[model samples]
Target: MDSSVSSLTQYGSFRKPTFPLSNSCRHKPRRWPLALRFIKGAIHHVILVPILLHTLFTCIIVYIHINIQTLSVPANIVPSLSIVVGLMLVFRNSSSYDRYWGGRTNLQSIGTSVRNLTRSFLVCGPDRDEADRKETEKVVKVLVGMLYAVKNHLRSTWGHGYLLPEYKGLLPEGMYGFESEGVGLVLELAVVVERYIKRGVDRGAFNAPQSSMLSSQLNALVDAYGKMETIKLTPIPIAHQIHQKQVLALYCCVLPFCLVDELGWLCVPIICLICFMLYGIEGIGEEIEDPFGSDKNDIKIDAIIEDLRQEVSVLLDSWRRGGEEYTI
Candidate 1:
């Protein structure tokens, strides 16, 4: 009995009813029939400062036209720069979306590996004797620990208050002091799992092929762990980010000047609309660049973790009740 294994048993006893889980932002549906869905978490919050500045600048330009005679930048200037700005925004958004989708896929892979490994441990693993049952339970606990560790690892939330209360004491004392504690915990649990597989193989409970298959599943889990680390640690290029922002600022600032003479006071609302469109798209890309964050558009890591917990609980329960044999 590993302490981690012991903690898992205690944790498992308090299972709650599982609700539907969503990977997207969990917004309550609006009661108003005419409410716009597109503006749910629009760029408004992020671009407030820029929007205010743009508004003030537009008012000044309008005042100049009315009081000090017509003063306007050539509207032709816009068409010249619009193409470059459009392409950069397109590329920036696409690149960030790729990262977001990649993180989602990685999380899905981790979930799949967890479910597969847990089912294999409970069903394919030996459970005839008390020792076999205990050992299998230990392996199951390690699987649970792996899931939590991976979640914490990607979020960079480690130590005392970060983990679920039940998993608090699961990690060894040594892990608590490590710099990359969450990652170290996952690696340590993976090692423990391998050791248990070997033990099962030596006990004549699992054949070489059975152990190999289980080991491969564990390897898949480890691979996912590494993939997540890659996504979290590797960010979009700094130069690209800086350049995009600069271009967006320049475009927004110059827009009002271009349109003022043509639209007069109407330029303020028009410019505001354009700012919303451009800045909103840019904000969305930035929000999802690292989908592990708490932003509305960020991947729902907490919900995903809960789904894994519930799935594992159900599988464990089925095993305890002595259900029909589970196949691969």
Candidate 2:
């Protein structure tokens, strides 16, 4: 029937292992107008508004040119003004890109954490648990659960403060977590797993070397989580952002006037196009600055979190059932 109703499902059962499902599923992106996507979201710089200003000035200049009592002004001065505006636009666009890239680099760190954690969990597990091995098997599945939790936490895709429908009921209820708190929880989970390993070693269920290696791996995962949190929360200073936006707006408004003297009536449409392009680009950069937002261009955090939840559900369920039986 419907996947969303009960909030959990396996891709299969019995003879085959199934892919887990999650309730935090996301829908496809909503399409925005081409102009709005580029101008409003891509170029938060509002670059086009300045161009509108320029267009206004150009319109004024055109009116003046057509009715001028004399063509006495030097032609070379107008060209110089055009050059200056162009240089300013170039600088503004370049700076916007720098901000966007900085955010992207931060998100990439999550991939590193995922790889390191996954390998460590798989490698450090006790292999000799065939006797009363059910508990050990369950813990192994917890690693899968942990992976999904970490992914959902980073994405901010949660329901009632839990990772999602599949994971929510399993975690401690009533506790809400932001990025910083989520990292703390992840570290705590590592500690829980470490304790289990120590217990296993003391009882001759696991080896000493494996326990130590697992500890180091978990620690590395914790470190990566911290770094990601730092990037997600920290942003460029407010004053700089404000100044950049204001300067871009003012520049666009005066662009049309500068062009009017050179292109005559043609400056109207040309200036409008220029303004739209610059503004759109700047808007895109602004949205990208915080790729975690709900904006159209923002990263699909909900979807990522949902996938994590689903994958984790598979791991946890398979573990609880005793991994030996999970043939897939």
Candidate 3:
């Protein structure tokens, strides 16, 4: 079965997560052939229509200048448009990148909180008997579920039907149902974890100070959730987007006339290349603006959740073998 279809059936909605391209500057990367890079680039797939049209437009302008009429514009138009378009594209890309980086940092915070709280429960938690250890394990599993819930909420994949098999039967009876508001299920799971933290206090698993610390970690998880929600819901201003695109189109349309006077026929390829660069930069901003989506440039959220799951499992297994004396 197609992965998209399978995810839709199992989780109600699916955002197929792809690994993000590397941006590390610590070391240089192997350079691929220009042809291969062009073939594999996302810009080619998205900007093909506009590039072709721009190429044809450039050809028409060149033909008119050569044969029918000496149609031309002052060379000053090139640098003039270049400055305005350059500033707009720079601001657009910068703002979009800020949102992308913010989303990543908040996700890291959530993962850190989960690990801290789970470790506290397993090692410092009340593990006097088999039942206590079992309860701790259940709480760790709930932490995993919390991540999945957050993932679904960000993707707008609501409802209990989206719960995976591992997360099933974990929610309290009668609590699982359609989550119209999107955050209800995630909040419910947080409440469940909080209740267990309180139980640990009642059972003498944690002192007042320790209990307070556990609660603080839970608060951090909720804080990260709220931050992510803000990123997902709030978008860049529509007015700015409209004006920038208008200016970009205008610049591209006039560029050929400015260059046709000097370069003549050679201006065709030059204009095409310039169009590709300008449109490609704009397209990248558009793709990464909302980093939570399933775009090729969006964060690999599914992989992040799975990594947390495996880490929690490994910690719990080590604790079980060490009989709760595991301090890490």
Candidate 4:
């Protein structure tokens, strides 16, 4: 028991530290009270029309079965049909969650690459003269601008007018015409950064090997951009989504007939409860599948970008201090 305790203590020490940039951590899934949750939850909003309609249908079925006709379905059919519907929901929810998690992973990769490249640019590159210092500062600003441009591009918010004021001036004069050229603004900014790097090489600020390393970091940034684009653009097939909804609707519709015989009027509320659960599951999949939208459940990219901005500011400060002489 002592050995086990010691191992657990060691494991606890190595656990990952939480940061505000992670939307899942910063904006934890809320647990409103049952009444409030019905009003506030995204799932409820989506399934409200269906639930109301189904509840009405359930009442009608129940009334007809008791007053006019003896309506019922074999109890065994419920279990058998449920198995198939459950599998379909599981598959859909699983696939959507995978896309969500993959998007988060790519976001972290982008942050990591930005930090590394900025550090290398500031520390390893030359800053021997005022001109050299200004060049380094320009490149650093462009690096950050590229990050913001990527975020805007993913959101489909184009135009240089959308960029922050400080970063706006740093962009090339003709950059406003990026859309006309059929090139992504983020890619165009990358091209600008590369040109600055090439100029640095020509001026002997970076040795060939150092330049190569920096270029690899730039590649990582673009690779992450490509991956996130794939996530944003390539949604789960519409045909599969339509099919799943059809099956779920069928399940909810048939569930009442199966229960009305055994439970009678009590099955009305029971049907609502079951519809809420099943439709809620499918609704959650829709909410999280994209992970990049402005929805509360989507990634908090604005927060993440703000955090990155803070980090870049600190790095800039460090670069300035290192250039100054200190008295002991």
Output the better candidate (2/4) by lDDT. 4
Residue-wise C-alpha lDDT for candidate 4, range 1-328, written one tens digit per residue: 8865785475446444444445334365556655565554356788789889999999999999999998998878889889989998999899999988888888888888878878877876667788877777777877777777777778887667545563564565545746656788778778877886787788888889988987888888899989999999999899999999999999999988899999999999999999888988899899889888777678877777767866676567557766332101
Each model's lDDT: 0.76, 0.54, 0.80, 0.79
Model 1: CA > 4 A from native: 1-40, 160-183, 323-328
Report the candidate with higher lDDT, 2 versus 3.
3
Q: What is the Cα-based lDDT of residue 260 in candidate 3?
A: 89
| Candidate 1 least-lDDT 10 residues | 173-182
Instruction: Tell me each candidate's TM-score.
Output: 0.84, 0.62, 0.84, 0.85
- lDDT of the structure predicted as candidate 4: 0.79
lDDT of 2 at 65: 67
Clashes of each: 0, 25, 0, 0
Comparing candidate 2 with candidate 4, which one achieves the higher TM-score? 4
Clash count in backbone of candidate 1? 0
lDDT at residue 124 of model 4 (Cα atoms): 62
Candidate 4 residues lying further than 4 Å off, grouped into runs, are 1-41, 162-174, 321-328
- Tens-place lDDT per residue, model 3, 1-328, is 5865764465433324422322212135548765567654365777778888889999999998899998888878678888999999999999999999999999889999998998788777777889888788777878888888888788987766335564674455456744764346678888888999899999998999999999999999999989999988888899989999889888888988888889999999998998899989998888888898765578877767777776776577667777333334
- Candidate 1 C-alpha RMSD relative to the actual structure: 6.4
For model 4, what is the error of residue 88's alpha carbon versus the real structure, in angstroms, after optimal superposition? Answer: 1.0
As for TM-score, the candidate ahead, 3 or 4, is 4
Best-matching candidate per lDDT: 3
* Candidate 3 residue-wise lDDT at 310: 65
